[model samples]
Target chain A: MSTDRLRDVLRNSTEHVDMVELTDAALKQSRQITVRRATVGATLAVVLLAGGVFGAANFWPKTPGDGVNVADSGSPSASAPVEPGPSTAEGGGEVTVPPRIDGAFLYVTENNGLISWKPGSSPKTLIADHKGGEDMIFETANVSPDGRSVAYNTTSGKLRLRDLATGKARDLMDVYEGNFCGTPAWTPDGRILITPNTEGKSGLFNPVTNKYTELSFTVNGCQPRVVKQGGVLMVYFIDGSVSHLRGIELESGKVVVDVPNTAGSRRATDMSAAMVTADGKVRFTMRTTTLNGTLGDGLRGFGGDSLFELRDGKLVDLDFDDRTMGAAYQGGDGLMVLRQKIDGKYEVSIWDMHQGGGFDTEDEPASLKDALPLGYTY
Target chain B: MPDIAAEFTEFARTHTPSLLRAAFLITGDQHLAEDLVQTALARTHRAWRRIEEGNAPAYTRKIMYHQQISWWRRRKVNEQLSETIADTPSRGDSAEDVALQLTVRKALLQLSKTQRAVVILRFFEDRDVAETAEILGCAQGTVKTHTFRALGHLRKALPELADAMKGNV
Candidate 1:
């Protein structure tokens, strides 16, 4: 009877629940999840093959009159197989730094400090004892559109810009107190879109002139992605119980495209970072959690990330194989995906959204076996 | 043979009431309880084919607990103290029963999320320490510790319910 009393109390607590409404909401969310899974499975065969032709060609040493060298300084040939770097134990291994991929230098945080790594060379420490002493620099640090500077926020709330050439760092603004979103996004025109301030004021900040232009409209989102042709800024933000992707026209400041997540399904689709194509196609990385014992034993903790592209206002999977691709950058004519191969190698392949073709393999000067893609030379 | 959707709908309709009751006790908020149940069912629907022949309700409850633990922590501001327990003449409950239920509900919410889950599993669901630990993906020792601490808090908060809670402690 005592046990019944407790059970009755618990049952009475839910007496007000509307069963029909709850069932309908659950069904709708289930359909969305099904759609997401099917979309991902369909795009599996649409693989970016090995050629590295379009944007990756720029990483190789160009013959005279080729005029293609951007971040090129390594001796690795385009076709020759360079030996893999000496391996280390899983967590304590040596960092395999990559050669300049597509003229872009990667800035990563190791145990020592923040290091700027180029192809065929060792990682040079840019800042010793940096404020944010974690590998999370890869999440917040973005290479400028020109690849001349890297902008990263410190744990102390200081947004600092480190020049790749001079290695000098300076404070842009103190945004630590505000609800500063992660990863300060760079506009195509080379200005950084600072996450909105506490007052909901966002602006385009020109790092060179140290000038800040208030955006025509106030937008709220984290991980803002912009296309090169720049009509709208794709912003990802969670409002209350749902996550949304709203395309705000840069000029009018009006929301042009609004993709709201289903109610009561926040964890089902966690859009951490997104990439916007010139034609307005958006691909985002969704982080899903594993259902501990129920799902599987191997997938106990974080249920790794899945790449999804927003098509016709629905999220389709963008992953082709087991290899996980990082944030894509606008290359010459298409988007360049930096894919980590299953055999412990890195491939910088150009994916033409319209055309399907084979990718050419080019050997990176040093293996970026443990590096996170921050930004690239565009 | 019903398709996945049709089968899932029947499953959702049948199990949603118990899921809602458990979720309401776990979250102590009607809106969050509803959301928790929906989210759990959504995930259950994803692995429906895999778990359809297996224990679907257990899988759903596991998802509900895990999701609620991760979610309510982030949305701490929205966690409302549950309303007073509704009086039911059909249950033959008196005024003291209502007060005791209200006290138990409020006291349950006061414990940490993990402790609250442990208490609910051990007492309400009648799960042993091993089962509670397995459901929570924690060690049996953790469940025992949480169980001891939770019952201590409950007995301290509701002295009237102390005799009923004796065996568990």
Candidate 2:
């Protein structure tokens, strides 16, 4: 029909509509939405206020005579027997005591030492500078799953654990004589440390019994990330140009799940990191490209480097882009600890995979201050 | 002090019928149309102070158009369209007009979302090409192409409507 006739038909068709009733209904809905938004805003404000108060109460120093000791290890010569009450400093200033680092914390390697950081507190250097020589590196340290102990390959090729509470370091094993290459992956129960040994083999070192057992499987040039369930390990290896994720049953050295050519491209897949979930599913971040061109070059070109999870026995894209640099499975909650590049700085964030599967950064991303360039674990 | 709620309510009271008609044309479902209008109005109410008094209808229309497209893109399964047309009169309406309306509605649904939006804006809303392009966030040439293709689809779907247009011209 003609444009004018079409307009007339559309306009006339609405003649029988009850405009007043629709308006009332719409107004009510609008008001309801407004009320809901206001309520959410108020609730958020109250929650933030409560959180601030709670954080201050928990982290703030107690007043003088509050029966708290402020110990300074560096000032050992001034080790006076601390009374039950808080004492004033020699300079007459109220002594401020550092709060104990509790809950899950991060152990980051600095130049040659390790720094421990909790969410609300400042980072504390647990290990002093012991820079690596030509054949030994002291920075490849792994924090236990419980965040209690830190195990590192020393410059002298000794595997040592530093008790965070006692600030003492003790040798666990000597997996290598020089140049320890592989990182220590801690099991879920914190009982075993899976260390990569010489000659493309892996060894399980128990700190309690000082017993070391070598595995039969060879994971040459690959990092073994352990899953929480069933002693399964997600071993990432690159053979020639193709990358593979092999799920190995730790006890029997049996390969259960094998995914060859992770990106399903003939091109080389350069896998950055992989983490296994509690349910034994593997999630990895990698970049794949053909010989000459970028990622979007081949037939069935998946976009640039993104996160993918092995779901239902196939690699499924998680829609995350290259901004995510590293991810660690946050215990059993289906939430992952993600290190993302935001505004040119690598910031730590928590991504919820269970609820709609995206990074929920409404809160400010945690800063990776005083952290080593590469090593971080959750 | 002017009551924002009262001002918004009065605006809705005067404009709900036309807005509902536009939403129905966009979504082709009565319940969905009501939902679109409500969502648009709620957004408009939230931004009532920032929007100029004379531009409330345009602002609400923009929200409804964009929201409809977003919902269409996000939903995996297409919802079944209701067979009963609420706007079509039952007793007094001529059967020919009802049939023609039904055919036009069906033809409109067959067009892609952008094409359907172009058709409704160009013909029913009487928007110029440039205005429709700006509203649809597309180039003027793209709007013209969509309008041409939509008209071609409608003419093919309803040859009788093409003849009626020719006779009217």
Candidate 3:
């Protein structure tokens, strides 16, 4: 049977959810007004910080009395220029993006402990304490592709980069880690760390040179969907309508292809985009849109976003309730989820792609162990 | 307060079905699913301060997962298991219930709780190992093991699924 047949069987099962009932439940607990208030409030707070708190938020000492000496470090920038990674990371000196994501997932204990899920049948092992203080309000945490490195920030702004491979750590100060970030991505070259800001900017921090460089802004207010395209760090954006894709150069702020916006919802064709990895040829794009919020923007309330992927010239389109945030695809390899269906009233649901576009099964396993040897134990 | 009430009410409305489904999977009782939803909400309400805006879905899901696990553990020690599904259609008689769904659910129950959790997290939730690991509170390896074992159990229970899962795997 064709692959579509199996997917159909999965989606068409009689025991599926009742969509109406689900929507009823979601709307029951949700409020349109309060969410707007909170959102507006938060945005206002950000605005305040950007204006008056700038000197304090961006370039000030932690304590009120302790003055910041911009030149105390006596360096052009707090971070030095990270020499371009060797030709390649493994041996060539430059860091190479891994074709696939492989690593163990570690969890911090409820209070202050760190637990690791290693390979094999063994239970989780406690790795360390938060050293920061139990007041550790669950800051951001990230793991490297090989699972040998993990970095996180504490309730305090102190940044901690742990070498899982060596059990050592290098601390970076004044990080201001927010809830969104875990750690910087380790490029294939492994020499520089890459981070994208919601405001359409990318940051490269070179630990070796202690220098930091900000890449030209590409996409903002959304996760700059990252994928390894053509051995280069590529991020793609599918416009609001899923039409028009542009590849933006992070370093030089170049738009490779200038894709125009889709004709709007009135048009039958919706534009979406995503990344595919079979061979090494993909482009990093920073897409732009042209539509404005007229009345539909404020009155219709929250906007929506489609999580799409472009693979083999195919656009896998998915939808999200939160239009501001982008979908995250890990490891730049193997079976990137193209689109997910959202029931009315907003529930995140990724359909069974193999089963002809339906929700994922409740009984299916969580890992890809059936296909590849896995590194995570949980 | 009105907005909070509205938001809470909305959140309860939309996610209640899935939450009920999840609660039902763990509790094996409809009454308990209702109670589980209520219990989870009380905690969710308390967490509203921290979850006011950002990633509310993720925050709520984490709460639901923890609440289910807690509900499972805190209940009275000795529990009774129901052998038959309360509502099931006869096999040859396809009019009443979905034979496939019932069969899958039955087979799913055969595995241990964690295995079921892994299966649901991996497939149903469509989360990567890191995300799944976060939800299950286990290592990525455990997620993999549970997944493989769950699949193996499913196949042994229903070899017919092999045809459907073939290319996708």
Candidate 4:
């Protein structure tokens, strides 16, 4: 038939399809997929770091006063490690990290609950009832420095912690009245949880006494991570448009490091920012608009922002390979997770700054095999 | 930033019917057509911020086309063919019109996935050969070849429409 006739036929054929119902279902699916992607991003970061230090002796040097002890060089005995079986929960499975990676436990938040897995042990669900929904808070939950407790907020705005040893969950406090609380950051001492409220304010909740302390500072967008040097680095929209990274001292509530004030750029986008603190340093990704009042071509499309590190009080370009997409998160003991987009697939790797190493710099690329092919569990 | 949910709701309300039509032509099943539109819209929702405002419908269309091909490729073996056409008569459509529509859909099921996609994008969607090639991530020549082959198959399957096909070709 004529093309117009065919178009008319096709268009009229869908008269019975309910657009409203389809859109509603699509919206729910979209939100779930976004959450799943965020969880996958965090899980991949941890797995990349775990794979990086797996098995070689003297890979990580323990530093004094560092809170998160990811590895003790002499801890894993000379005995052969046990191989863990498959995961028992639905949509959960065991990912085999290389046998050489000793004492590395990867904690992933899947649809069923928070799961913890070692190199060879079967994946075990730490909390069984953790159902992910629209109200589920936290992009990436914090595993305490001692690795004893996992802290996250539920969809109902209640901050809860699950004891890894007992699989028992304890309600810490009601964080807010809604579903979208930003991820909480744990202090170096693991004594307090810094939770971000949807409305520009942050609260420090002491799990010991179940008390909440409100911070005087306000963040316009995105959550903040606590730096090792007793400062909180947050990305906030200054004047509602320009994104700025300001470091505030936890005790005095004073802005210690305002990169935008020193660097002289006011074009950052609020939502297009991510920050990670490792080795007493901060690395962040920010999207900036050009002088022509349009987003730069580099930051216009998907995954198109460059990572910058605050070094010597200046924002220095990490200058990773053009293929490197962005930085994800910083692991304990100076490991930074970076994602490299090669041929449209994201490959996660760990960058070590303490080894005089930087992305696409003097550091050798970590050799990691593709593990955890569970494929977007949520 | 605009409220993403509200913006998406408005966009979907305006475009969902058209998208469902395109998806119906692609999938050749009513239930599967609704699913295809929902999946495409869901993907578009995730990238709504990155996609320019006027490009939402085009973005969703692209996702629908790619997702249909991917699904066909993954489940080609298990796809059950409907032996009979299940056509719901539209208002003002006579028995002959409904029969012709069912015939066209049946002929569509006979074409290869790529050939069917090229036909839908080029003819029904009115995308030029270059635009079809760009959407399908193929060379313009490939789109031309697919369109030619697909039309030839349609003409043979529905001889009654051969005159119209000849006029369009």
Candidate 5:
């Protein structure tokens, strides 16, 4: 596909597929066991059996290195299938880049407490730990979009809004098993936090009055991803360089964005961020050898691929360099540019938006504001 | 065992899509798909303990698939246009892609329920044979057979998509 063509397709490929009727039916199917005093014990016993699985794995579908097997149900790749390989479950990701280096990475605690690394000149000081051993991580701990105010999940599994200001915490919902790690999200209003599985169906829990308003839908869950465009909660996963963008509104739990990979007849769902031009061209950030060396080694053959379906009658490939892109999110504004070192010093360059996007030797950001070349931070 | 409302809310927030995806794939109609996903999710919510204990996506998918297959048992399931994506106009590099997707979807609807399940799981979910088998609770060879036949049926249904397979990544 041509570059312009890919951008056009990505820009316009929108189809809303609502499955709410299924929600109603699914809700009817669930037999809600009321958690009263006598049954709470039995309920806990049940939760211990189920919820305990969550504790067993903090992040499933993490990555190759993150050393933890939340579940072994994942079938080995036919490309390479093994029931269980060595537990190469290291931290599991190439997130060793910047933004992360300076930021106090947000992680969920077992009992829902947000830990922050307040900036200090000394060796990374742990300035703020909510000291929340009382609640489960799923309920209490939530990080803000701007990365402030850590909400508290309780031991009994309730979501509490904790004000970073005066150190006061209040119960947002007493009836919820709301947990942050469980992908709890705050609505755009922040007045109500959205959760699923209430009213014998999926519903929203109000923080102010501690009540849950039953939504007509009866399903639970979304991956809890956010889009910069509409501060609403949604899900977007990239496959190779092309991204499969799906936006969901937490309000009615509707999927607003469902752009099928119409660019050619391809769908490589192995998505990662490379540099993208503001125009919506997605590129690759890392350079990796194929599992079978399909593309061979080091530059050449039939490599670069960027597929996009335009609204017009044509599908095109966006132009890009593949020498620099491999498989990691470089950096970007509209174009995902990255800072790579040249001759012992770092320089900012345009990253390839191809399937295995590469780095562009040309195109320098105007110097004065572009000290980024010297490695300000990735 | 947690507060019913709270447990329900949390559950709803996360698992709804899995249900819908399974349903939509099974019954080509978006409305019916929504019903299937909702019905399966609600039932799962009822037995939250068992649902929670067992694998979630699989449990929900099983419920949804079975519900959809037995649609004749009760026609309470609505088959109509839904309000969710009503305004979403299709914009692809080519109108052909949208046409292709719709065509593929229609073709999928023509297959047997299990055959449809095999295709959706294998290609859409990108699962290998064993995982698709596990999700379907069938023997690995059954999954392979289903997938092979499903592909053949798809190729027969949409020769254009069949021709494009060589370019698939």
Candidate 6:
């Protein structure tokens, strides 16, 4: 319509608004917000100050390359994904796999309970048999952002941190039975975000000092992402039949934006992986999960996941077709989506969010298929 | 001074209708419009003392527009336009007006969320370019660009209403 007619129609439409109902709801929610603020204040009182003493210190000693583990394994095939098998090296019959490609680097869980990877030269064994456990014992072994540490969960329900340089694995905390801390997402500054219970008592656990800061709000969903640029902790939860994607501000612990998936809309019903793009926006995948499905595989869900970009507080469909089980990583200047074919082959799709060029897919290692970023946990 | 609770309630009730009109235009859905207004009001209540004396309506409008632009949330279904408006048609309204309203709503959804916000603030709310830019937290140049693009989109989407508009915008 003409600009004037558009204005007239909208102004006249307000006659239909129920002011009393709207005001009441707003007032009630405002009261709840006040309560939440109070809760955050109370929780802050008990935050362990011991971790702050370290003050963002590197977990490993600084070496050349600014402590970044660029030690590349001498495996002839550099692009091959690591597979489970017996070690080929002739030293006391150790079983090991090629280092998994994490962005431009790599990491691997040794059968001897060591989380270590050397990037450029022959692999460096941090310690000789520091602990005894099969490779399968360590679930969700994720390399840290600085490539100096690995955060993993044991099958015995312990959240453990392994220093790749020292080969020391320390227990950070004990998780509840039947749940593994395998879904830990690392912040940009390298603190592990773990929801150790079903009640959504999530918080950031610093591996350097093993201190935890409980979040003010509970997150019922797994795979919570802390987008530093957006300053919001993005989460996905289901409220009845409607799935909700919310951004909780990290500093204030306030939910700044909430998008709900309503029936008949193309919005995400269930979200999968989320990663901050080069332009500082979070991109995630959404799929519908059936009751019969398992939470393993990071809730890959039925019919695969479709890509969506969070823009201007709305979920803009990225028009990506799916079966995308895992995708996230800041590998290059573009955003990456790792998709797996039904035949078990994996490929990477890179899309430039600001630029409108469609994504380019190239065959990639299955190791790049992770729910979190390349160096983050499953 | 009046009771803070009562004062806030009165403020909410007084401003909600006008807020919903702008919200409805931006969201293009009756339910989402209510949600946008309510959320903004709730935030305004938190800062009530600070803003109550210093233009609470503008503060709340800024929150509504900013939240709509920068926040991330899951999608909720859009309720049918006919269902909400049928019961409360203003006097002298005809079927043609209703049809036009629905058509305009549909056409508005075609634009990006930011584009729609620019159109609503500039046209529906009669906000000047600077005011619209301040509310949306964007540069004035962005508002002008979006306004130009949005008007072109609307004209194309609603050709029957395309008769030359007398409005300067």
Top of the candidates by TM-score: 2
Off by over 4 Å in 4: A1-12, A15-20, A38-378, B71-78, B87-92, B167-169
Cα lDDT for residue B123, candidate 3: 57
Could you give the candidate ranking by DockQ, starting with the highest? 2, 6, 4, 1, 5, 3
The runs of at least 3 residues in candidate 3 whose Cα sits more than 4 Å from the true structure, single-residue gaps closed, are: A1-115, A126-139, A165-167, A177-183, A196-201, A218-225, A236-247, A256-275, A279-307, A311-315, A318-331, A335-378, B1-169
Q: Using lDDT as the measure, which candidate wins?
A: 2
Worst 10 residues of 3 chain A by lDDT: A294-303
Q: What's the C-alpha lDDT at position B120 in model 4?
A: 83
Q: Per-residue lDDT tens digits of candidate 4, residues B1-169?
A: 6899999999998988778777777777666777778888887887788678698877778767765664222133125345325544456677787777778877887786778888888777788988888777667888888888888998899887676666443
Clashing pairs in 2: none
Q: Is candidate 3 or candidate 4 better by DockQ?
A: 4
Please identify which of the two predictions, 1 or 6, would achieve the higher DockQ against the true structure: 6
Worst 10 residues of 6 chain B by lDDT: B70-79
Better of 3 and 5 by TM-score: 3
lDDT of 6 at A5: 66
Q: What tens digits encode model 4's per-residue C-alpha lDDT throughout A26-61?
A: 997777655443444455545445533452211112
Report how far off residue A157 is in candidate 5 (Å). 66
What's the distance in Å from true for residue B64, model 1?
Answer: 40
Weakest lDDT window of 10 consecutive positions for candidate 5 chain A = A369-378
TM-score list, all predictions? 0.42, 0.46, 0.33, 0.42, 0.31, 0.44
lDDT of 3 by residue, B25-65 (tens): 55444555555565556546544664657555565565455
Question: What does the lDDT read for residue A158 in candidate 3?
Answer: 49
DockQ of each: 0.14, 0.17, 0.05, 0.16, 0.10, 0.17
- Tens-digit lDDT track for model 5 on A1-378? 332332232222223455343343445334321212123333333444443343322121233432211111111123211111112212323211112222222323332333332122221211233454555433324443223334444555555565543455665554344333333444322333444442324455544335566554433322222222222333233222223333344444575544433344333232223233345543222223323333211111111233232234332233221122212221232223343322222223333332222222221222212121101111
Worst 10 residues of 6 chain A by lDDT: A67-76
Expressed as tens digits, the lDDT of each residue in A213-312 for candidate 1 is 5666655554565543243443443332234555675545667666653222222234434556446566554443332212111101111245456677
lDDT of 5 by residue, B1-169 (tens): 4586566656665777655655665665556666556665665565456444436556666656544543231222222323322333454336687655556665766676667777766666567888777666567998877777876787788776564332221
Q: For chain B alone, what TM-score does every candidate structure achieve against the true structure? A: 0.86, 0.86, 0.74, 0.88, 0.78, 0.82
Score candidate 3 by TM-score against the native. 0.33
